[model samples]
Target: MSRSRKVTLRAHPHGPTPGWAEVDTPPPAPDSTAAAFFDVDNTMMQGASIYWFARGLAARNYFTTGDLIRFAWQQLRFRVLATERSGDMSQAREVALAFIEGWRVEDVQRLAEEIFDELMAPRIWAGTRRIAQRHLDAGERVWLVSAAPVEIGRVIAARLGLTGAMGTVAEVVDGSYTGRLVGDLMHGPAKAEAIIQLAAVEGLDLSRCTAYSDSANDLPMLSTVGRGVAINPDAVLLREARQRGWEVRDFRSGRRAVKIAVPSTAAAGLVAGAVTAGLALHRRRQRVS
Candidate 1:
């Protein structure tokens, strides 16, 4: 039987009003197959998921406006330089984790699903979603691979009717976060590594699998698969795409595609906020916890 479409909105035990739904997806297991993997932020959607989550947290009084600004700056730095250049991504990741030090894991998951369905869902590129659907129609498992927390990734997959997702793992103690990561944030090389592991576990044929992303930060992920498609590529990535002769689809090619990213800046503006928030968090970490 398919997953139930009915969503039950209720107050979470963690003291938040979030809509929860029964999840029917099984974790990855040994299975021979071909799959399509898509990056979530700036690839399938117009902006970063973490950015919006942070905004949600801000609205909930988790942090201040200055915190969000500092966060955005760091995220922008990590996104712009991590793939093409050597720079520590942990600087951005640590603060993002610390931003929700005492948050309950279940609460974040519920909130992410609700926020995505209400705010970020329409922000997802129709063209990108259509591409994923085509893969699903072809009987391929579609997974959303992203640096965002695995919870957010799964929410995106479930909402989009995809198979599964792979994302950065955050550490939790009991039901609350420990403000730490279990491993490297799923960025740059980490994304490739995660896919490799997933492929092995699922017995997937990498030679027949396809991967898609929009940033050079995802170069490793885009290159690891047999087929790589660049969607809404920036100038740098577009240049690389041309050099590699990889297929590319510019969702920003016209005003029509711009609707998915209304004001187009909504996603970008939030992403830029990650950097500012990260910086602020870093400074705070220096003086306090």
Candidate 2:
């Protein structure tokens, strides 16, 4: 009794690109009984998950402001290059872990909770959230899948009360980050592979599953599912979505829920309420210098 809806956003291209060209995609199935997969970065949020994570780290002093600025610039440059090669994926991981050295697994998890409301909530596409809720209301599983780290995924899933989430996992030992991923990056072809493996583990049928994405890079995941809906897809994906007759939509003009930013004081309170030793840890680090 559930159906998929394509929620598109107006693409904002920085640098020399000016803007993204219009795209035409296919229609989706009239009705479907399947789980829906959501891409976390541009698809679910306003921008990249890694970018937000870097900002959060910088705010907490885990990363310096300059480090975060460089990280953001690197991301911008990478998008401009438009390369989907796996080597780029490897390099991204190294960059992410380099700044997170010496961070306790628990502290990051605690900060993720604060940012979940401050940063993550506002970035979720309204149309996408509605579609996901519709499926959940109909008793279908709604999973948030992403290449972002597991802590980031968990924060989002918990906030939304989602059934589950699948994301990149970093190696951890003795309650600290090893700064290394235990497996292949969860992107491009790897995303599709994760879905297939998840289906086997969760006893779900791939032929009955649905996936929603905004980028051509997610083709492997979109193609693997029985139902694929492209939401404001990229040029390359728009052509493929049209060929496959997948549903596409542009939700930029629609009315959306207003998101209020949690004030710095409120965020500090939340962090304090979540952990008694939060401020102590910050002070302790200062005294060591």
Candidate 3:
């Protein structure tokens, strides 16, 4: 007999109404594999979604070239040191809102469509995509979790054909940007909470699912899954992952599934050249002697 799936929509106490569906828990299918959750930024790509936002804003002409220059400078300073300055985040929010303040929602979505193909697709990690495909091919659901605004996350979800996406919900009023976020930011524990809620609605058993990430900030969400994998994890996260016995994968090109060797492919060419030069010198010395 076929299993019935149920969906539930729950109201947000402090934010815009979020629609969610609750599923009646069902027995695992004979062919069903575990679901996989992915952290979108560093784990799946080389940088953060904010970087893409800068490009997106420029494409829409929402920001002047000068504005982009300022944004780039801030991005370089804050992210390089891995510091979360509240002032920086606030400033970022302000700039982001100003860019889309009066833009029609439809226009923004259309622009997202273009940005997804141009900026996001080619930059996505091949190993990450392979892992996502492995789960999908095994008949498991895939979710994209990020701290980016819901609208931006939705665009990425659509591009990847994912089952759903959970992200920070920026506040909007009367179909215009409100320059503030609604509810809790979808990060750390909030991310774990969202995943649990999503799983409950889909009748998914958390113990049978998997999650992948690259930072310690995602610990809560990663811990929620039965199998958590750390991909190209940061220093702190690498130690934590090892302690917790979590599966780990290196996303750099030509990197072995084991320890993160220097980014291969490009580095390999340099090594080969050095070895060839060393051999040539040794042969010349032998002939001279």
Best by lDDT: 1
Question: Per-candidate RMSD vs. true structure?
Answer: 13.8, 15.6, 18.7
All candidates: TM-score: 0.74, 0.71, 0.68
lDDT of 3 by residue, 1-289 (tens): 7777776667756778565555677656533435788988777765665456545545655444554343444444534333455334544344333334444677667876787777877767878888888787778999888876677778877777776778877667788665466766676777899999888878788999999998888999999989999998877889999999998897664434322233222232222222223333433555799
User: Each prediction's Cα lDDT score?
Assistant: 0.75, 0.67, 0.67
Q: Report the C-alpha displacement of residue 125, candidate 1, in angstroms.
A: 0.6
TM accuracy, model 2: 0.71
lDDT for predicted candidate 2 compared with the true structure = 0.67
In model 3, where do residues sit more than 4 Å from their true spots?
1-34, 71-99, 253-289
Clashing pairs in 2: 26-246
Please provide, for model 1 over 173-267, each residue's C-alpha lDDT reduced to its tens digit, 9 standing for 90 to 100.
99988778888888788999999999999889888899998888789988899988999876778899999999999776576555544322345
lDDT (tens digit, per residue) of candidate 2 on 125-244: 788888888878766788888877778888888888787888888788888877677787677888899988878877777888889887787999999999998875667888999999
Q: Whole-model lDDT, candidate 3?
A: 0.67
User: Which one is best on TM-score?
Assistant: 1
Q: Candidate 2: misplaced stretches above 4 Å?
A: 1-33, 69-90, 253-288
